[model samples]
Each structure stands twice: as structure tokens, then as C-alpha cells.
Target: MNVHETEVRARALGLLRSGSKNADVARELSVPVGTIGYWKHLDRAKRGECPGRHDPKCPRCDGRGLDEPAYSYLLGLYLGDGHISHYSAHRVPNLMVTCGESWPGLLDECELAMRTVFPDNSVCQVRRTGCRNVKVYSKHLECLFPQHGPGKKHERAIVLEPWQQAIVDAHPWEFIRGLIHSDGCRITNWTTRLVAGERKRYEYPRYFFSNKSDDIRKLFTDALDSVGVEWTTLARGSDPFNISVARKASVALMDTHVGPKH
Candidate 1:
């Protein structure tokens, strides 16, 4: 390659490392996207960063299009109540989502989302005292869920990656449903009101999502905002750790999409 070509390749690699996709890098450099991929492949080879084996199931590793809606839902579940752990003996990773036995429908939905994301992988449920652990094993769990790391999710920063944010943007309701399924509830509170002369019972429905992580709460509320749902943050003592949606229109929207966890 000529000097100009070499400079363009270097800039493309920098952009890719900075989270720019191949098409974006191509547009910025005024080069074909295929050429950008070629340069990236060559750069990885030059740096000896190629993996010994590649899993085609991993969208990031193999450049396959992900099932964004399913992924968005799964991502919400993950951020809410899911965890990833590696087997010490074999290094294989497992992604587990804790689902309450009370909501068997939610448990089934969680398993379905996992299967949609990893069609070839096996999803199973392990019974716990009051919940079932819906889990799937995959070598590329880390690739799918970059948030997997040491410590609890609330203990660490829970910012979503750019790609993940895109998925959430495209399917905010599904994402909200997943989060609500995992850590939220829909309840009705009633009170007695005097209408003219007679006392009447009035009931109002609300949605509440509770998570200890401030970042996760922000993400949930952000999604709510995107879908024109009004939410308020509730504090426990001095710590703000809950989001509530009680506005009539917002509640109707939630009922249309999420409803109660069957």
C-alpha cells in the first residue's frame, strides 16, 4: 500500500477500536466498507490478536446480525437480575437469569429470549427455594454480554455499550418489559373518596421498578422517557433506588405492552 493508503488504514483501525463500526469508518475515510473490514482483519493478524477458534454464533466475533429485539429484552433481564459465571474447570461461561416461581410466564419468556439469542445453546431451569435460575452455557457469553465482570452489577458501573444502546433504542418497550419482569411490579392501590354524598372506592394502577444500581435505574427511566412514559424516582430513606410510573397515559401504555407478569 502507498503512504496515503497506510495512513487511512491506521485511522480506520483507531476508529474501530474507539467503537466505530465498519460502515462508519468507511464513510469517514471515504473508502469501501469491505476495504475497511479487510484492513481490520489484516491489523488483527499483524497484532497477533486472532483467536484460535471463532464462534459464528457470536455477533461481535463473526459479524452476524443479532436478533436485536430479543437481545434488547435479554440485556434488560441481564442488567436487572441476570449474572454470568465461568466454570473454573473448563472456562466455559454461563449466563443465568433468576426468575421467580410465581411468575412462571416470565420464566418461560426469559428462557425463550435466551434461546432466540443463542439458538444452538441449551437453556435450562434450575429450581431454587423461591425462584428458578434460567441459564444457558456458551463460550461467547462475554462477547454477547460485555458487562460480565467481577463484583455485583450495582457495585460496578453499568453503562451500556454503543451497540447495546442502539438495540435498546430500537426496541425500548421490549427492554422495559424485560426489566419490569425481572425487578418491577404492577400494583393497584385503592382509597375511599366522597363523590357528592356517597363514599366510593377508587383504585389506581402503577408500575414500579426497583434496583440498587443508580445506573440501571437511569437506564430504565431513560427507556421510559423514550417511549413517552412518565416516571418518578422514589427514595428509600436517603438513597434513590426505585422508579415509579403512575400517570394514567403511561400506565395505559405499560398495560398495553407489558401488563402484569402472568
Candidate 2:
């Protein structure tokens, strides 16, 4: 390995010793998480440690890349709640190049980025198509012929919207809030009632019921605060409520607590 490669490996080992998840370390280091496993194996060998017999021609070592890198990159965008349709060869090539790394580090970095960007949940692969070679069309061709011609054999290209990109760019809390609001679920009158007067506090459902909600709420508040939004907490019964608004901020603070209404 070159000097840079050695440095990266050393940093990775340090991260592993620090109890960082292998997948997280991989992503941060832009390597495959499985590479960590290989490193461990190598380490054991160097120390005359014996691990059980393992496959010699593992796909990763053989240079046959795994889907982890691509998965990790997408995970950074989705945070475990978005859809991925693999029909765009042009787009996929760029993504692969950008995210290309060994599985261990790639997976680790992807997960870490997800946690930092969206701590509420891990990125989930909702859908995936078969692994097939896709043709990357030139930009000029794409612009000139936006639609697929009759002779095209490949699947249709997938288009991601600006809102989707926004979710990818925002922190986890912001992403979750956007998802929730985008669902178009009507706010409950009861939840809104808490914000009407001094009863600003509200409790979420059971811990299990709210799952990722609390984390998301905290994240949103942090984002709000960064923008100079003044906020205060109120107590209503046992529940806690947050009241915040931006200074010279146009976005209205929703006074309503989010909950299911019967």
C-alpha cells in the first residue's frame, strides 16, 4: 500500500479499536466494511493467531465488488425510508464511481453519515431490480431525447425530484418532518388543542409507539435553533411541548402536537 493507503488503513484500525461499528468505519473511510474483516484476518495471521478456515477466493478479495458501496451511498440519501429504482444506467454509473469503495469502510461511512444526517432510522432498501449492465447515455443525448426511443433495450431511467434531494441534504430530523408532513395526514384537533393557550405541553404515544419521533423532534429543534429561532418548553400534565419561532423567520411554528386522533 502507498503512504495514503497506509494512513487510511491505520485510521480505520483506530476507529475500529474505538468501538466504531465496522460498517460505519468503512463508510467514513470510503472502503468496504468487509475489508475490515479481511484486515482482522490479516492481523491475526501476522500475530500467528488462527481463525477457522475461511474461503480463499472471496468475491470481495477477488475484486468482484459487492452492492454495499452503492447501498451505502443510497442509504446516505434515504436514511432508510426512501425508494430506489435501478433503471438509470447513466445515473448509476456516476453514483458507483462516487461511492465506490471497499465494502467495510463504505458501509461504515454510509451508516455514520445516516446517523449524523438522519438518526431516527437506518436506510432501508425498499426495492431493487436485478443486476444488469446499463448503458450510460451522453448528456447531449439525454437532453435531446428525453424519452426512450423504441430501440432501447434497457429499463427506463429513474428520476429523483428536488424534494427528494432536499430530504437527502437535510438532517435526519428535518427529513423525517418532511416525510411526515408530505404524507398529508391531517393534524388532530386534540393535538392542536394543547397549543391553544398555556397547555403547550403534549405527550407522545407510548415509547414503542413513538419510536423515532422524539429523536426527530430534538433534531428539528436543533435545526431551528441554528437559525436563531427562539424556543421554550412547556409542561402539560406529564407531557412536554416545544414552542419555537424564527427571528425574522417566516415559517409558522405549528402549535399542534403530532398524534393520532380518533
Candidate 3:
């Protein structure tokens, strides 16, 4: 682990031992509660209390690329709305991705993605105030999600290494699906038109993604461009901007590849 991770893990553990709730600790640290929970599991495993999903001799952690389908899909989610925390107190990485509680389907998809990425680990979901949290414990996760760092994604650079770029180039659609499912959404846009002599409601579907980081926005659009998915920039007078694909064929293509998150 690094110095920042070491400091955060220490703070989390200390705060927890001092009668602080996991949520409170997370709030104080600007991290997800699942992150503190991962530290808790690590504290147990270190004392021979819990058998964690950790193996020092695992080949996946032998400094090789983990270019897999699950990782590709997860990359999109991470860039969109996921957060990966590397704690020195834990033996592996803790990844937390949440969606609104109202969208159980999205929550289910996030859980499924986590399970697929870490089949040997148990994915846990915690009910928060307005969102559902999905946490996964796996050592190999850090390899695939090297973007794990401090502050918000928009506040710093979000560049991918050469290895990660190669994986994304190989699975562009999966990346797009994850991004759309997380930060973007599919919706129907209706407009009144003259079908007969009077008027008719024409409904069309579209996919949109909004992010503050220019790098993230570029990454998302580049992935779409690679897949021949045409999208346009939507005007928004804010820091984080939105881009969308509303053409008929493009929507169908996204539907076939990504579909609705639920």
C-alpha cells in the first residue's frame, strides 16, 4: 500500500475502535462505509479470526495484466460512479459501487458485476439512506482498477495505463454498457408531430452520460466512437456536462449491447 492508504486505514480503524459507526467513519473519511467494513474484515483475518479471500501466491497478483470481461465492464462503472479503496489494513482491495435504491435493477446489475469480477468472494449489499452499496473483497481488483486514488475523480487526472487502454480497446461495448448503466441512462423522448393531418406523439429512445472530468468524458466518447455509436453533446450550464445518443439506429445498437440497467 501507499502512504495515503496507510493513513486512511489507520484513521478508519482508530475511529471505529472509538465507538464510531461505520457510516460515520466513512463520512469523516469521504469514503464508502463498505471500505471501513473491509478494514474490519482485514483486522479479523490478520489475527487468524477470518479466512479472507487472499492468497499471496495467487498468479493473478503475479504482476500480469488482468484483461477480462468483468474488469472491462467494471472499468466503465468505476469511471462513471464506482469507487475503489486500497486500505493498508486490508489484504486486498475494497470496491464500492452504488446506485439509487429506487432502481433495484441497477443495484442488481452492480451486484452481478461484482460477483462476476470476484467469484471467490462474497459481495455484500448495505442499505444506506437513499442508495444501495455493493462491496467486493479481492486482491486482483487493484490491478484492473488502478485509478484508485484520493479526492473526487473530477478533481484530478483520470488517465488509463497502456494495459488498461488495451483491454478497453478490446471490449469497447462492454465499457460503454457499464458507463451508460452507471452515469448514463436510457430514456424515451417524445415529441408531437404531424403524422396524419392533425398531430401524433413520436417516442424515441436515447442514451446519455454526464460527467465533470474532461478526461472521463473523453474516455466515454472515445469508447463510443470506437464502437460506431454516434452521440451529441447536450448543452448544460454547469461544471459536469452531458452527452447523448438519440438517433434511431444508435439507440437500437445500444439496446442490443447495453439495454436498460434494470
Candidate 4:
């Protein structure tokens, strides 16, 4: 059915079947290499060969090393404001983290962490109303993020594997930074104080992280504790959903490392 003469087609097929590379066969037959590849692909398909089955670089499946600090930060972001979509086993899943448009720097950092974690895959940004969904496509996303599951993260039990915990234990500040960048904020509060016979205004800065999940809050606070940053729980009505870091020393530590999101 191809345009070439029947004899030429038979010769090409014969050369291909004899283990000749497409480029060599094309040079010998005076044909485009792509045509030779196409013929080979068709031949394979007719013989029941599956298409596009290959291994990508994956830490868990391929026994490759991971960037632990980046993984720790990405894990915090995933726990705070990210999700993985799995359509089927034959297709790769997408990992997405929502970042506010106001903080372009945070978006860049999020994308960088994703790229560092999955160096062989592609990372992209999808714009939404007032936010951007920074995403990466990888076949091994679930292997990296075991916290992925059904329903909302808060509804399900969110626990880290031992290896993940060890990484968090080593890079606690990066983990806290990722969480703060996602669901926390650094703000200033001011009040009038009597200092010299006249009322003077004084300002103090603090960091606050709010999440509906008790386990997530505990994880954040635990990381803070590991790094010697003091934190307290603030209750809104009956639900204690806020973690506040207002102590002078703790605020200084946070300011030095995870300052206000830009």
C-alpha cells in the first residue's frame, strides 16, 4: 500500500527483519529514515508489540538517590496545599500545588522543588483565578508521596513513613518554610503603649499557620519544636485550627529563615 515499488518495499522489509538499523537501511534504499521507522513500527504493532513501554528515572522503582531537602520541602507543600491526580496505571499522574499569584517567588520555588525532585520529568504552571497551579507529571509520584489517597487529606489519616520523617527531622526549617509558604502567613500587629509620658505605638510580628487537619498542624508544630521555635495553638470557636509563633525568640528565628511571603 505504500508509494514505493513492491520490490523496494520487500527489500526494505527484508533489511529491517535482518536487524539493519533504520538509518542504514534508508541510506542503502535511498529512502527517508522516518519511512523505515514507520514500517518497523507497523510491523511491530501487527506482531502485537506494545507501544511506549519504557522506564523513566524514579527513585523508588529505579533505586536512584533523592534530593532529601527538596523532597522534605515538597512533602510539606504537598501536605499543605498539593494533590496528585491518578487517572490510570497506563498514564502518568500529575502533582499540583496551588500558589497565590501575589507571591511569584513562592511559585518559582515550588516549581524548582518539583523539578529537583523529578529531574527527568516536566513541570508546568496552570493559571487559575488569583492563583497558579504548579504541576509536575511523573509515573512515580505516588511512590514519592505516600500520603496521597481518597477524600480530603484532613478527612484521612495523614502520617509520614519513617524515611520521610527522617528527612523532615534533618531539614526541619525547609519543611516549615514550605508549610508557611502554603497555608501560613507572617503579619505585624501594633498597639499603643505608654513609654515616656506620651502614648507610643509599638509593632510586633508573628507567624500563623491555619489548617483544618489536626495531623498537619501537629506535623508543623513538631517541626517547629525540633528547630527550637516556640508555637501555640489558637482556637476559633471550639476548633483549634491555628498555630501561632509570637514569642520574641521564635519570631526572630522565623524572620531570619521563613520571613513574610513575597
Candidate 5:
């Protein structure tokens, strides 16, 4: 049972000994009026009798597990184009992900992801110099996403926990969709072919995903592999590498799984 210390009990007794009202003592101590009232009822202030929540520091978040589909996709985006930060004085961590402004619909998807994880937490948006960002504040985010590291992801190692890995295994398509939507796009490639002794123009569709983090790129490729999709790295052995899935079969598979940022 949650009980109070002798200090609080003595203070409440001393204050009640004076002419101070229950509300006055509550205000002075930054506790609930009912808490002080209960203290007086018991002739002393105690914990279980108080009206405050069990976990005062974080009453809203259990800081426990994660949502399946939402977290898988959100993790993909975090690996692709997200960052986490926290302020001083026992502040909760904030997960901030940015995307190009042209795709306003992505904001809704991101908001859904945040709400999926932190149903009671707040999600906000802001427009930067050239991009848009969706931010969520919660104390449990770091617990779910332990990859929360400093500096660019490319400059550090990005790995997944077992539970997160299981989510990706079950929801590989959603993870790939999120990665492609954030750091990649669908494009129609054009080429010229001879038709009946005449030069004819033909078009084919392909998907491209690019990122600076090698580990993140590997994670994307691994998700694709899980779905039996083929990808090739372009301009290999270079900074800011690119991955393209252009084979007719691979393109068809990707088209079925991932689409334009809507």
C-alpha cells in the first residue's frame, strides 16, 4: 500500500493545528484539496488515502509496449528521416519526423502513427524552412524505440530490438511502405526502342529508395527481402547511396505494396 512518511504527517498535523484551511495547505504543498481533506479525516496525511494518482510523475503513459502496425511503420520513418530529443528537468522525450511539404497527406499518416503509440499524448506539427515536421511528446517513446541515439544515424549504429524485429517480420509491407514513402518514390522510367524500323518511346515504372544511413538502408533492403522483392544499390561505395527495384517483377510487387505519398 502507498503510505506517507512521518514528515508529511507531522507537517499536516502542524498545519491543521494552526488556523490554515485544507485548501490553503493543499495550495501551499501543491497537492489536491481532497488530499489535505483526507489527511484531516484520518487526523494525519497519508498516501493511499490521498486522491492523487499512483504514478504522479507520469500518470498518462504506462511507458510499456508499442502498437504493432503503427510502430513498425513509424520505426521505418524514424530510421529514414526522424530524430529524437529531450529537454532538461525531467522532460519527456519527443519524436520528431520530417517530410517534404509537397506531401501534406503524409502528415496525417504520421499523426496516426503517433496516436497509435501514445493515444493520450499530444501530437503537433510545424513547418520548417523547406520541410514539414510532426512531433509527439511522451516518456515511453524511448523505451519502445531504443535506437534513440545521438548524431546522424549514418554516423552511428542503428539496430532493432527483438520485439520490434518481430513487428517488422509480421508487418514488413507496412515498414517498406513507410520507408519508401519517406526516403523513396515511384518513378516512370523512359527509354527508346525500335518498333517496325522506327524509333518508339516506351515508359516503365520503377521504385527508388535513398538514404544516408547504411544500417537503415540495410534495414529497408531486409524488409524488402522479407517480402521477396529485389533491390540493387546505385552508385555503390559512395555517400548518400541509393537503392532501386526496377525489375518488372520487383516493380510489380512494390507497386502492390507501396504507392506515392498521398
Candidate 6:
């Protein structure tokens, strides 16, 4: 194994010896919490304490032939997105092990865990069309990206796929040459609904195109309305909302205002 993985394993073993819970070890190490159970099983096997069939008394749940349900429960949460609330971590495991049923039960267990973890947080499900099928993902927006948050300047966002990237690149005059003066721009998944029941959604990154004119806001708003898409204006001072349509609309608006090159 690599140095990092070795160190993580050693640290996990140490945490177990120190009476630390698996969840604590996982969070502290930033590794999937389920790994602690795996190491413990390995240790039990090395000691020859594991059984040949249906062992039921292993203290670490390794040789007991029990399902090590804790590992599966924790794995699901980690795979779903390790953004659980700090408070919920302590109680979620117990509930999962005790709860019967299968996949749906697991989902219900997670939903309960999420509610307990983020009492005030709001959750929303977004559906999108993919090449293979329509897929749905759950997302939670904590709030507008903080103006002065640390790390990378931009918030955690979904990366665009190749086709989406192509559409974005085709409008390079607006995205690359116009909106951002930096080396490149990023697309975010933040959406705002101008009116209820609108079929199309609008994405707004934290930045926008050029900051040239005062009437740019109205111009863009009018353009979106002209195309039958409603929009909400965010007061971001000189920064334009980092959205594809906004970039496209802004380019069109600027062209109209400045007129075609003679």
C-alpha cells in the first residue's frame, strides 16, 4: 500500500485501541469510516480468533459472522455524500443496525439521519436528463456563497460534462474573452426560479461577464424575458452572475448597444 494508506490504516488501528469509535476515527482521518471495521476484521483473522462458521461472539463483530451491518450502514452514508451534520454522526449507526428491511429502509434511515444532522438545513431533489437516462440527485444549498470564504475562491460546484462544456466553449467570446478576465471560468449549479412552474432553470455562478455598463442589468433581463425565460437579478456589484445564458444574453445585448463592427 502507499504511504498515505498505510498511515491511515495504522492510525485507524491506534484509534480502535484507544477506545475511539469507528465514526470518530473516520472523520478524524478523512477516510471512509467503514474502513475501521475492515482493519478490525483483519486483526481478528490474524489472531486466529475468527470462526469457520456462524461465529456469534466476536467482540469486534469480525469473527462473529454477524453482517458487520455497521460497515454497510456507514458506507452508504459516505457514498451518498459525506456532508452529514456533525451532531447526527453519534446516533445514526445505532438506528441503522437496529432497523430492519432493505434498500428502502436504508434510505429512510439516511433521511432520518440527515434531518437529525442538519435540523435547519433544507433539502431539494433535482432531476436532469443524461444520455443514458433521466437521473436525479439531491442537493442542499447552505446559503449564497460567502463573499470571503476561504479556499479556491469558488464554492463546491458540479463540473460540466463534455457536451455542456462544448456549448459553453462555443460561446467563448462571452465566457472566456468577455465575462472572466482570468485564465478560465467555472460553471456552477446554482439555480434560481424567476416564477413557479417554469420548465427551464437558470444557473448562476458567483461571477459574470464584463462590468461595463449601468444598464446591462435591464438589458439582460429584457433579453431573457424576450426568450420567455424569467430571471432574478442578484446584487453582485460589478461581478456578473456566472451563468451560460446570462453570458450569451449579455453578449447579444452588448452587440446591440455597440452595433456591428463597421
Task: Give all candidates' CA lDDT scores.
Answer: 0.84, 0.35, 0.78, 0.85, 0.75, 0.35
Top-TM-score structure, candidate number = 4
Each prediction's TM-score versus the true structure: 0.77, 0.21, 0.74, 0.78, 0.73, 0.24
| Model 2: per-residue Cα lDDT over 1-262, one tens digit each | 8999899988987886677876798789898554664554345445554232232222222443223333223332332222223344212211111222222343344344433322222221111132111111112222211222333212333333443334334433343333232221222222434454656644332111111234334544554455344545434565553333322231233223222211
Model 4 scores a TM of 0.78
Compared with the true structure, the alpha-carbon lDDT of candidate 3 equals 0.78
Worst 10 residues of 2 by lDDT: 131-140
78 Cα displacement, candidate 3 (Å) = 1.2
Best by lDDT: 4
What's the lDDT for candidate 4?
Answer: 0.85
Off by over 4 Å in 2: 1-212, 241-262
Report how far residue 17 has shifted in candidate 1, in Å. 45
Clashes of 2: 25
Higher-TM-score candidate among 1 and 4? 4
Better of 1 and 5 by TM-score: 1
TM-score quality measure for candidate 5: 0.73
* Model 6 segments more than 4 A misplaced: 51-262
Clashing pairs in 5: none
Model 4, residue pairs in steric clash: none
Give lDDT tens digits, candidate 5, residues 1-262. 2356567756866897687886688787776444555456445214232211122223124545557888788888888888887755224467889977778778778878876876666465655767767876666666777898777788999888887788899999989988987788999999999999999999999899988888889999999998999888898665558999989999998878777787
Better of 4 and 6 by TM-score: 4
> What 10-residue stretch in candidate 3 is worst by lDDT?
51-60
Comparing candidate 3 with candidate 4, which one achieves the higher lDDT?
Answer: 4
- Measured on C-alpha atoms, candidate 5 has an lDDT of 0.75
